[model samples]
Target: MQEFFMDYGLWLLVGLLVIIALVFLLSGRRKAEQPIEPAVSAEAAPPPAPVPFVDPIIAAPVAAASVVAEPVVVEPVAPAEPVVEPVVEAPEPAPAAPAPAPVEPAPAPVAVVPAVAVVADGEDDLLRLKGVGPKLKALLIDLGITRYAQIAAWNDADIATIDAKLGSFKGRPVRDQWVDQAKYLAAGDIAGFEAKYGKV
Candidate 1:
């Protein structure tokens, strides 16, 4: 081994130094060959604009010079009925019965009047006088007063008996008044009769 080193030692050292220099020269040449490139922007280009369409214009409206007028009317109406009347129907007459054959009145009975002469013009049916209605006549008949003299004969008590028997007359004076009227009737006096009853 010592002998081989001695023989090739210088040649190996020289060959190593030559290889290192060659690598340095090649690295320097690669750096010189690299070029400096100019800088370029990254922005993109814009597209073209679109065309527009035009429309026609319209005119304003015009007004008329004169206007016509219209008229209005109103009518009065009658008011509704305030009250209504009911319809009236007249009553029909009742059918009549056939009358009996006329019988001649029996001759007037002979009166048993006292001897005093009857005044020819004196009213016979004194109850028929004005102011003496059917009710009063019935009262006199119940009291046995067939004539004015009989009524005149009645005392106050007798007249009261008549009143009690007749019950309350719906609208006449008491028995005293009836007796007094009988007395006046016997004398055939109208003024005396009117004094007890109002004007006939």
Candidate 2:
């Protein structure tokens, strides 16, 4: 009976140890499954107090230096005064004497001649002569030659003087045989004029 008691007691001790281990595992598992609570922070600490602002007083010289940093404008200078020369007085001129009275010129001598002389019984048509047109007739009348006889009597000197005065009609006298035509016409010989110089 003593030997049987010892063997059974060992088996009983092992069974008790297994039951205690199961009890410890079950307690740890229950603790892990529970939710954890967060810790609260101490008071929220108030924000640090703001620092007081202060203005600095600057010196007048330092302020003036800042203003002087701007550009400066310079005005143009005025020109110098011009030099003046001394004025001199001119000498006075002598007084002029009274001018002498102008001398009167003597009257020119006047020759007495008749206004009209008997050169022809009456004026004839000088234009009847060859080369004598209305313009030539006017030029001849201006020279006091309204008669055919005057043209017939024209010498070389008279022809030259009259031709020079004729201007555009200068060579007409000699060119058309005006003197020959005048001679026949002055004598009232139309036949002679036509015979020597074709039809008048």
Top TM-score: which candidate number? 2
How well is each residue in 1-200 modelled by candidate 1, as lDDT tens digits? Answer: 98899889988999999999999999999998999765655674554576564333321222232444567676778888788788787887787777988999987544332233345664247564444677777665554456677656665555455545556563242423555676777787878677766554
Clashing pairs in 1: none
- What stretches of model 2 exceed 4 Å from their correct place? 1-121
Highest lDDT scorer: 2
For candidate 2, the per-residue lDDT at 157 reads 66
**1-200 in candidate 2: lDDT tens per residue?**
87887998788899999999999999999999998865657886766899876434545667767775657799999998898877887878887887988988976433321133356567888767777899889987776777777777877767777777788989998999888888998899999898988787
